[model samples]
Target: MSIPSFLKLVEIQTKVASVIPFLLGTAYTLYRFNSFDLKNFILMFISLIAFDMAVTATNNFYDYKNAKKTYGYNYEIHNVIVRSNLKEKTVLGVIFTLVLVAVICGFILFLNTNVFVLILGGISFVVGLTYSAGPIPISRTPLGETFSGIFMGFVIVFISVYIHIYDENIVKLIYNNGILDISIDIIEIIYIFLISLPAVNGIANIMLANNICDIEDDIENRRYTLPIHIGKENALKLFKVLYYAIYIDLIILVIIKILPIYSLFVLLTIMPVINNIQEFNKKQTKKDTFVLAVKNFVIINIVHVISLGIGAFS
Candidate 1:
């Protein structure tokens, strides 16, 4: 692949879509908690970007392989599959293997060999790989939304937090450092979880919208994704549910003081969400509106992170 073609194959836009929220969440944790160990954070961030790129490359490989088999070498799935210097499957497999090794080494270097981290890493690896590969790809199931919500939202958030704060002596460290000026209580953990909820839901809905756009192709390939299983109209309703639930949860957290009242800055995301919702309602073709909605979704996450960072720092 030429330089421009290689850049296109990486799909920088999609990468930003997947990575910005994780970056925001990581930044927020460091900023609010003052857990700014730059070296470890950089390692974790690199591992995360690698994992994301590898998974995306794997998905592209799978789609390309299947398209080839079905269409006898027609490049109908160019948007889904990146054309490149190497065979898609070979490229994906090599990237996935190398990234998996890097992620393991990264944990060993930056985190202790605790059971929690090990278990979470195993779960994340399985979910991430099976999302686009394996006999029972999660992306092909009715549980796509549910699986994505858990993995991208809860699991990723927990793992990122754990990576940053997973020493056996973390409580002692926090107490000694005088970070947050509070005890390492259940309330703090719950608060972090609450704050992560909006970003999680936003990401899950974004995936749902993307899957909905590809529903026809998925159905033709015998992949029964959530959007196909639920019907597009119902999927739209679920999208609304996901969007509203995040804000509702944020409000509840603020009301109960689990999140600071100033965290209402997150509500600024409402405008983008509403705008995307309106565009989704008006647009007929999934291809026509899918990219627009995804762009708005990325903006929403970016705004959410910025808002939360400001509130936390202020």
Candidate 2:
């Protein structure tokens, strides 16, 4: 495929979803733990991009494969495979190659770290593949937002931090006589997961917004996503609520002493966030205004990252 087609097929622009949290998590590792594993961080970033590309390609490939012309998902505007004249085998090959490379990178990092990394990475792999490749793909369910949010948001952030501290005493893994014993720092993991909810909510809103805009087309294609089961009005209400919850969770993070107080300054982005939300509230069309959600995602997460940076330096 050509450059533009490949980019669109992979939805390269949305890498911000993964990239932002990777940065935020690395920042947290640097500031709070006073640790930075540049080698693992680099490997993790590469693995992340490769896997993200695989996920996007898998989503687009399946959507194209299952698309119904009766619902107007024709080649002219939908399905990069048809629009770019790429063979089905060619797309599948690319997906396989991307996944293979991602797996290799993950394996190297696991070897450099510990079995804990391997187990956690294995969970991410299962969830990532099931997300789009399963007979009943996660995207077709009401739980798409929750799944996408937790995996892409919290899980990645958790993995990023875990890799930097893989040798820490928080988690223990023992292998004897072919039996594996595993232990984890439950409270620490829970703490990060809770603070990570802001990004989780933001990432989920992106999927939620996309589902809301594509509700009719999705139903015509027999994919009953969140908006379809909940109705557009309720979905929109949930959209607004998720964005607002970011601030609520940020406040909780600070009050709990997990996040530095300076990170509370992220609340300053609320005005623009609400403005974008209102614009999306006015129109939910994919062609016209679905980008409001994407824009909101960038604004909220970037501001949060900056807040963390300030705290890191202070």
Candidate 3:
């Protein structure tokens, strides 16, 4: 396959969904812990981006394989496999190669970090694999948004921060005489959760937007996504709610001093994001309005990460 076909197969443009959150977590770690580990940072970046690519490739591969309609929008234009006339074995080769790279990098990260890295990395690996490849793929179910948001949003952020502060006693495991004990600092975990909300909301809205646009197509394909289950009206409402919820979470974070007062400047970008949301509310089409969700995500999180940087640096 050519480079363009391969990039399309992996949906490389969508990798920003993961990349932004990774930056958010890194910024938060710097702000909260006042420490940085370049080694682990590099490892996490390679692992996270590789896994994200692998998961996207896997999803596309499965989607093409299982699609019911063979001559329409999805088959002809949307799916790269069908569009590019790529061989199945070649696609599988690309997917497996990406996954192998991700796992190796993640394992190296775990060896340098702690048992929590191993445990959480394992969970993320399972979730990413099962998200689009299993008999009952998560993307085909109503839980797609929730799972994607929590894992890509909260879990990635938490793991990013944790790797930097693994020796901080926030969460620890002790094993002796075949018995194990675990400890956690609830306050710190709560802070991390609050800080993760913007990314969570943004990522969830992206998935919701995609589902909303693809509802008819998805239903015809026997993929009962969230929008199909809840109806588009309610799904749009949920999308609006999730976007607005980011500001509320930001307010709480600022009030608690989890984020610097400078971070409140992110509120200035809200109008543009709201505008995008209204446009999306007006029309929900994959080629037309789906990008509004991505625009909103970028509007919110870019300012968010910049605010974090200002807070950390000053």
Candidate 4:
């Protein structure tokens, strides 16, 4: 592929969306331990990139096929389908094969047949494929948002942490280091909670927004997404609940000292979240607001990683 074609095929925006979570997990792992095996880190990074690309390709292929069956080869769906000229079956098969190979290589090079690593990797692979391609794609169900959040939030975070910190030596280090003993436990729990909060909220909000935009289309397609199931006003209320709950959770974590007081620096992310909420409240189109929500989520994750690094290492 030509440079421009290759870039378009991979879809830089989609790649960034995939990379943000991995980056957050990596940064958190490095912060907690203050060190990483460079070779393993590089391998994991490559595997993540490959995983993202394969999933993107697979989702686009499946969505395109579904859209074509319903909409009759419309250009609107064509534009959204990556590598649109390729046959859907061929694209799906190729991407799935590539992802399986990548996972195998990842396990061999970085994970060494560890059970936790295998389980996490298997879950990720299954979720990524079944998300859009299964007989009952999770994206089409009422539980779509919940699944997205958990996969992106706790599962990904836990996998990244496990890969980086689960070696015998690291376990021994954490056990022996008196200062880290209490802090590590607290941080791990808090991190899991906080990470899930934004992930769940952000993903739910995104799906809600998309459903709102495509309500007519989605209904016609027989997809019962959250917005369609809950209605618009109720969905907005759900968004508010999700939004406020995240902040409330953060505050509680801070009070309990599960999260470092310094990690309050993540409060800076609240500004964008507030702005997005206000826009949503004003009944603004969610398409206009989606970028803001994503920005806020990314900033919060970055700030959390930074604060954890500073508090743990300093």
In order, the Cα lDDT scores of the candidates are 0.66, 0.86, 0.91, 0.64
Most accurate candidate by lDDT: 3
* Model 4, span 1-314: residue lDDT tens: 34444344445465545465666666666655555666666666677778777776666666666653345322243334443454555555657666876786678754442555665677787887788778888877777778777776666666566666666332232235455342235546556657546555665566566566556666767777888888878877787677677777767767876566777887777777777777766763434555655665667666766776676666
lDDT of 3 by residue, 38-101 (tens): 9999999999999999999999999988988777776799899988999999999998899999
For candidate 3, give the lDDT.
Answer: 0.91
User: Which candidate number would show the highest TM-score if scored against the true structure?
Assistant: 3
Q: Taking the tens digit of each residue's C-alpha lDDT, what string does model 2 give over 216-268?
A: 78877888898999899999999999988889888988998888898877888
- The model with the greater lDDT, 3 or 4, is 3
User: On residues 1-314, what C-alpha lDDT tens digit does candidate 1 reach at each position?
Assistant: 35554444455567664466566657566655655455655665666667777777677667666652354222343544433446555575556575776587657734543446565666777788888899877777888777776677666665566566665333333224555332345655566667677666776776788777777667777778888877989988888788888778978977986555656776887877788787886763554777765666676667666665666677
- Which regions of candidate 1 are displaced past 4 Å? 3-5, 68-77, 80-90, 93-101, 109-115, 168-189, 284-286
Q: Candidate 1 or 2, higher lDDT?
A: 2
- Each candidate's TM vs. the true structure? 0.82, 0.95, 0.98, 0.80
Please list the Cα RMSD from the true structure of every candidate, rounded to 1 decimal place: 5.7, 1.6, 0.8, 5.8
Where in model 4 is the C-alpha error above 4 Å? 1-10, 68-78, 82-90, 168-191, 281-287
Better of 1 and 4 by TM-score: 1
Of 2 and 4, which scores higher on TM-score?
Answer: 2
